[model samples]
Target: MKIDEAVEIVKPHLTKSRFEHTLRVADTAVELTDVFGGSREKIELAAVFHDYAKCKPAEEMKQFILECDELPNNLLDYHHELWHGPVASVLIDREYGIIDDEIKSAIYCHTTGKEKMSRMDRIIFVADYIEPGRSFPGIDEVRKAARYDLQLASWMALRNTIQFLVSKNATVYPDTFYAYNELTRQINGGY
Candidate 1:
């Protein structure tokens, strides 16, 4: 799908601020593609719809998890904040016929990132986290690292996420741990 069509499809589904964030993510994803070398089209589409399900009702998201065979049941045990990406992945395919595996996977795991992420997945994941509007304690470091190394940038983002969740005493999703471990191994021999 063209970027403009994808944007139009998602705009009405998102609040104004979120819509703007999506645009920024697409921009960041394209920039990452330029630097890191991936399919710019796939990266843009995935980033444009990464947050497609962000504002979904919690119960509705739960239902999607319950009914979709592709989604794991364990997702219900975690915070709903992590549901949007997986839910959006399924919905975009069902609702809009976006059946590209790369796009779906990127959207599916954009939030909690899975182990062995594809280059496009890493781009979208890092793009979503370090998009310009996102202001947090360690985001600048991730953004700066993103300009050079995608994997290193992803590791930093995952580390910051895990640290933030730990500090808040929030439940960290298992996939988040798995992704962090995989990246750690790739970057630092799992030290």
Candidate 2:
């Protein structure tokens, strides 16, 4: 679907503030795509719908997460905040016919990134984190990292994310750690 149609379809899934954030993420994803040589269409779709289930009632999100046979069952034990990514992918695919694997995986792992991230996955993931609307410590560092190096920026974002989750005393999904390790390994010499 076109970006405008995607936006309208995604609108009801978000609150006004979240919708604004999603817009910034979509715009930022475009920029990242330009920088990193990714598919703009895929990145836009992933970014626009990444947060589609983010603000869903916790119980509702958990229910969807629980029912998702494809998702790792361990996710059921984690907090609902992580449910949005996987659940959003399912929702968009089922409701809007957005069944593109790249877009779906991008949304699925946007929150807790996977070890084997595609270029598009890294773009949407980093774009979502360092989007213009976000205001957090070290954002500028991440933004700068994103400018010239996708792997570097992804590592920085993942590091910051892991740290944030740690600070919150939250469960750190293993996929997140795997992504971090893989990125760090790639930047360093080798395994």
Candidate 3:
């Protein structure tokens, strides 16, 4: 799908800030794609749709997870903040005929990244985390690492996420741990 078409499709569903964040993510994805060499078209589309379900009602998102065989039901057990990415992944395919697995997977894991993430996945993941609008402690370091090493940047984001959740006594999703461990190995040459 064209970027404009994708933007229009997602625009109405997002709040003004969220919509701007999505645009920033798309631009960031494009920049990262330039550095890392991936399909710009696929990454952009994935970035556009990454937050498509962010504002959906919890009941609606739960139903999507419950009814869709592709989405794991265990998602409902996690914090609702984590549901949007997986829900958006399935919703885009069902609602818009976006059946490209690369785009779908990138959207699916944009929240709590999975193990063995594709280059497209890392791009969208890092793009979303380091988008210019997002300001947080240690973000500058992640953004700096992103300029040169995608894996290291990804690991930094994952580490920061894990540490944040631990500090808050929040439940860290298993896939997040998987992503962190995999990237740790990759960076340390253990993979």
TM-score of each prediction: 0.98, 0.96, 0.98
Segments of candidate 1 deviating more than 4 angstroms: none
Weakest 10 consecutive residues of candidate 2 by summed lDDT: 64-73
Global Cα lDDT for candidate 1 = 0.94
lDDT of 1 by residue, 67-164 (tens): 89999999999999999999999999999999999999999899998899999999999999999999989999999999999999999999999999
Clashes counted in candidate 1 amount to 0
**In model 2, how large is the Cα lDDT of residue 6?**
88
- Tell me the tens digit of each residue's lDDT in model 3 across 80-153: 99999999988898899999999999999998999999999999999999999999998999999999999999
Q: For model 1, what is the alpha-carbon lDDT of residue 129?
A: 97
Q: Which lDDT tens digits does candidate 2 get at residues 1-191?
A: 99999899889878999999999999999998887787888889889999998888998877676777867768878877788898888888888888899999999999889999999889889989998888999899999989899999999999999999899988898899999999889899697
Query: What C-alpha lDDT do the candidate models reach, one value each?
Result: 0.94, 0.89, 0.95
Error of 2 at 70 (Å): 1.9
What is the full ranking by lDDT, best candidate first? 3, 1, 2
lDDT score at residue 167, model 2, on the 0-100 scale: 96
- The deviation in Å at residue 106 for candidate 2 is 0.4
